[model samples]
Target: MAETAAQFPEVQGGGSLIVAWQVKGKTVLVVGGGEVAAGRILHCLNADALVTVVSPAARLNPEVAYRVAQGQVAHVDRNFEPSDLDGADMVLVAVDDPAASTAIWQLCKARRIPANIADVPPECDFYFGSVHRDGPLQIMVSTNGKGPRLASMIRKFIAKQLPSDAGRAIETVGQLRVRLRQIAPRPEEGPKRMAWMSKVSEAYPWDEMCGLSEEDIGNLLRFYPSGKVPALDELKAMRANPGADKEAFDGSFGFSVGA
Candidate 1:
């Protein structure tokens, strides 16, 4: 017997837990070759996931074709087979035929596979949100499959507001973390280290850190104690003169003045 919607009291409204999946080097099966499928395939490729597209008369867009020629994507020019989900980590169905999509969804459910049917939220195990990627940062905005267009607009707005030097800053902070561990190896300093890194991430000078050597970094860390962050005034001054000589003052500032 099929259970009615009222029987499931836990899920009365539309809400999905947004999460970032680590799909790198994992196989993702896309069960269509239309524009929607192509878009999903491109997203998977960007995440470094292995992608396979299945469609009987799959129509490839220009971008999809380029990737295909580059050997980044594998295309099985045939109808979707249940066996296709043999080793798939996730599945995306974008076929135009509603009946075919339903069938695929049912099979995926039986197999306990994560699946997303284009424009069909109720049948989806996950929703593909609008994604914006910086160098090492990725931001995703989801409307719970309600307003995709709105989600895309929000993504554009956020991308424009984000700093272009974010990726560089991330790398600098990464190096700083390694050096900090050397300075403060005690387990007690772990929380302090994280707090200090949080401050650095918020107000970092991406440009100044470009030419700094490892030794130069060590000089800056002397002022920051293992369990304390730099004073606000000191941070402010460094933010005011980002291009000043690093050796001019005590090695207490490496952040940007206008970050």
Candidate 2:
């Protein structure tokens, strides 16, 4: 299935490239209170973007309403105005009325602001794809606005296959990299650092290191070349001990393996 997706890129619709945006401390204008608008608000909030929702609808999603109460979001209880796009970094128009959506789209265009209109792909500057997040790790799957279900399925499948402690392990590896750079004997040690990183990539016991503190990680790195990082095969053998329980270990790491 993966090979087929790679061989037939034309089947996926084109027009936009998938890229992650850095939205922290930015402002986002959302022009509706419907479910779609609420979903967008959640995504923006997760990215640490300051969101302002302009809508006259009776109510919005409970999560959004709660945020408004907590001062994490600003809710303007009225219809959207052109001026709502005044200082917006981006816009989302998710009103049910087509005419309203079109109007908002035009306003966004006039202001040269990137916008997305739910239910109208042609008006979208970008499409939100399926995502799976684990701690600091996030994986996004997209079909270029062609097949949302396919993207969702791929996201779920990959979510299950990821190691429960993968996020923590990646952070630990990052710290190791920083340490290596600081202590490199020569400035031309790029290749040597790369080789060490490659070797340790599959050699660490991810599950065991899930609860390791910063000090523990630092100590481990100090003995890197002294066989501190165990081989994957060796870790597997250790996990096969009679007292070892895979399900319990996975649960401790917050992974839903059975899903």
Per-prediction tally of clashes: 2, 0
For candidate 1, the C-alpha RMSD (Å) to the true structure equals 8.0
Which pairs of residues clash in candidate 2, taking residues 3 or more apart in a chain or in different chains? none
- Please provide, for model 2 over 45-161, each residue's C-alpha lDDT reduced to its tens digit, 9 standing for 90 to 100: 889999999976376777667767788889898998887888999998888889989989988888899999998988988899998877677789988778989999999888777
Residue 174, model 1: Cα distance from true site in angstroms: 2.2
Tens-digit lDDT track of model 1 for 38-130: 899989989899999887544776766777778898888788989999999889999888998999999999989899999887789888889
Structure candidate 1, residue pairs in collision = 205-256, 239-257
Candidate 2 CA-lDDT value: 0.75
In candidate 1, which residue ranges exceed 4 Å CA deviation? 1-14, 56-58, 183-216, 224-259
Query: How far does residue 27 in candidate 1 sit from its true spot (Å)?
Result: 0.9
Instruction: Please report the TM-score between candidate 1 and the true structure.
Output: 0.74
- Looking at candidate 1, the ten consecutive residues that score lowest on lDDT are 250-259
